[model samples]
Target: MTYLGFYILMFLGYINQLFFVPKVAREKHRDGYVPLYDSFERFYLRYVYRRVRDCWNRPITSVPGAEVYVKERVTHDYGWSFEYTGREVKSLNLSSYNYLGFAESNGRCAQNAVRVIKEYGCASCTSRNELGNSDLQVKLEKLTARFLGVDDAIVFGMGFATNALNLPCLVSAGCLVISDEKNHASLILGLRLSGATIRVFKHNNTKHLEKVLREAIVSGQPKTRKPWKKVLIVVEGVYSMEGSIVHLPEIIAIKKKYKAYLYLDEAHSIGAIGPRGRGVVDYYDCDPNDVDVLMGTFTKSFGSAGGYIAGKKELIDYLRVAGHAGCYASSMSPPIIEQIITSMTIIMGEDGTDDGMRRITQLAKNTKYFRKRLHQIGVIIYGNDDSPVIPLLVYMFSKIGAVVRTLAERKIAVVGVGFPATPLMEGRIRFCLSAAHTKEQLDYVSLVLIYNYEKDSFFFSLFMSFNKTFPVPSMAALNSLFCYRVIIFFILD
Candidate 1:
């Protein structure tokens, strides 16, 4: 039945291409016009290209020393995409994913990175298998394994490429790959390109995952009773958009019961969770050996480029040779590797100072306080209470941009997420809280939100402009609503 549906869809698509689209000549001399190419160009210019011409590509500074500058972007009379208005404004940054506040130039990591650059220049200039591997790269790989409590590890030049290019090498045809529905785009692309039999379970639903696993195992491959060459389960430690943690323990139990290999992605969770910043495995107190492949990136908490795949010695050794990314992609630079090692050292408290501990402790506290304050103000938020990443719900799609722009106007930078990044009506503003964010910053954001919501300000007016007839809730009403939700969302649970 599934095969039949797939064929039907393919046939329909072919029909649409044949009948719905206009036919045209490739050579100008044949029909005096290249109709198809011209039509495509016109469609792109009229519909697709024109839309992006006015949005995106605006410049914003992300450096730490001074407040970040966002140059004013204006549409010129010629309809150019972007033109700077000679105006710059310093804005508070709340959009980046530097979770542990390590993306700074003044830290121990920066110092180490400088020394590394002096020794190794700017680039490795080649793939690891060729002339790219350096002593620093080897040291970084070892440090990664030690940090993740794995036997060995392999490094990749780019984080997204690490997953996209390696998954096919790890699992191929005749294998089965079970993935979370909300997994990152890179994972999705990897799974698609792997040529493996793929199935998606509901996000974070271990029960659903188990059911699918049971069915796949019982049925085996079609027309043959051969068991799958392998069954690999892929999931992320944290759902980046929703700020939800994976039910790792439950998933691990199911994987063990089914005798499947588990591949965990710790891109957002590593160095931001657990007592020693060891990642989800440590946070759950699970044996790292149970996880067949542990993947993570230094871009987040470690404040550097590149990624790693850490697991047993044999697996890392195999990947070193077989992972296409490591074989062809340019190796991570020595400076970047040293930066990560230095950051990991700080995270592990090997620097003999309590600064790392203090940052972690404060991050936890700030996350809790910020969530609680938003709850108190009757803001509908999504995610686990302790997660530093928070999503404030904006049920109306129109309000997403309005709210973000309003905050930006107030010198606060925020990211607005809407379809197709999320489902219709599930628009939100994702706030990434960092340890660098002071109490004053948090309080200011909270106050701004409350004030705007109360005054029916321009931002709030955008909601009304969208034909929303309902009255905006008053402060007292919001407080009462918050109290009610607290009871339902927390107290009952």
Candidate 2:
């Protein structure tokens, strides 16, 4: 057959299947879950789960920046060469968590990374305990300790593993871990790995946290009334998903009252909040000593990899000998360690300029301005006023794809978050403001919101859904049906 004829045949076949397949799939989807023993279950999995999908996981940028091009994924073939040519279009970036805009490549951090890469090569050769402790690593630990006003600090190769692996060393079977209901997945996993009895309090609710702590302390274990070996209160300085700041002062008060050790995860707030970007301890003017363990990652604000656990010298020493991650995981590369060190020095004003302060100021300004503009445009946004992360509600499952694709078409880059990152009806588009974003870029976002606000567009629908004043459309009923079914079939199973 001729090449043109073959292509024509393929197109026609796809057109036929597109119409017929969806109707059948929607019927099966609406009918609900197929029993495990039924033969049709395999057909349901193949048709519903595999065939029905959206254009996600596409490469959105050449580098991390305020603007960049993205490759569009073809819905059917799952091929790369469909919409993306060699050239990339510039799109405003509100997706990356580069809060202080330190994630840039051509800055001092990059220069330091290059210098270290040339001097020490790429990998650290082995784990920290197994011939991987370099002079640069030691320098980073000391600098981190000094920066956080702690006696000492220990570094881990991976941020997620730092929490998951170290918790086992910190707490054991008889311990009780009181965590925020909306704490990140890593903290939840860490608590699970520690084999501790876990109790959750409502997110950012000091009263609820106190109540839980009081009950845990008084009631003791399930029935025996034996006191817990250790009671650790785990919470984030800032909730990444909600963009809300933790009520650190109140939490610390509760921790003190209960004689509980407080573990503060400053992953998002470390390099992003505070007048000096020193995190919640600085932001709230709380005593750093009040926090038993201060955990943070370098990826968000430092523009590097790895994580750190900072506390008293004794705890640092104990973790060095006991923490499985530091002992088993590969050490951070010299380049990454130097990158973090360089970023830290800049933040500490050791680079001999007010650049760090300027960055923090600019980030704060941008966050405030963007949020104010969003509020003025009459869109419901989640997070604190000072928070760099802003999430706009987009409740319906269908609108998640529609809104994301529409924004992409408008040359705006943002992340569409859905279950199980949030509840099924609470899906949203997350925007991370950075110091790199200019006034004009922020202005454009406001313009977009205002333009759609007046019309009966997706943004209008979203705003109405969030406001609670406007009634949800009957269309939401159809959307919820599929959303619930998918949740049950995939998550509950």
Clashes per candidate (backbone, < 3 Å)? 0, 2
Evaluated at residue 5, the lDDT of candidate 2 is 38
Report lDDT per candidate: 0.78, 0.80
Estimate the TM-score for candidate 1.
0.83
Clashing pairs in 1: none
Per-residue accuracy of model 2 over 1-493 as CA lDDT, tens digit each: 2334334534654565567553332433435765434544433333322332443455865656666567655544532124445556578888888887877769788888999899999997798898898999899999999999989999988899889988888998889999999999998899898888999999999999999889888999877889999999999988988999999999998888889999999999998999888998999988799999999999988888899999999999999998897678999999999989998999889999999999899999999988887775556789899999999986654456667767777888788876567874576889998888999889887766554445435544444555563222223432443455566558758
RMSD of 1: 8.9
lDDT of 1 by residue, 350-438 (tens): 88988887777777777898888787667889988878889999755346656876887899877777555676457688988887788
TM-score for each candidate, following the candidate numbering: 0.83, 0.82
Q: The CA-based lDDT of model 2 is what? A: 0.80
Name the TM-score of candidate 2.
Answer: 0.82
Q: Which portions of model 1 show Cα errors greater than 4 Å?
A: 1-58, 64-67, 76-80, 456-476, 479-493
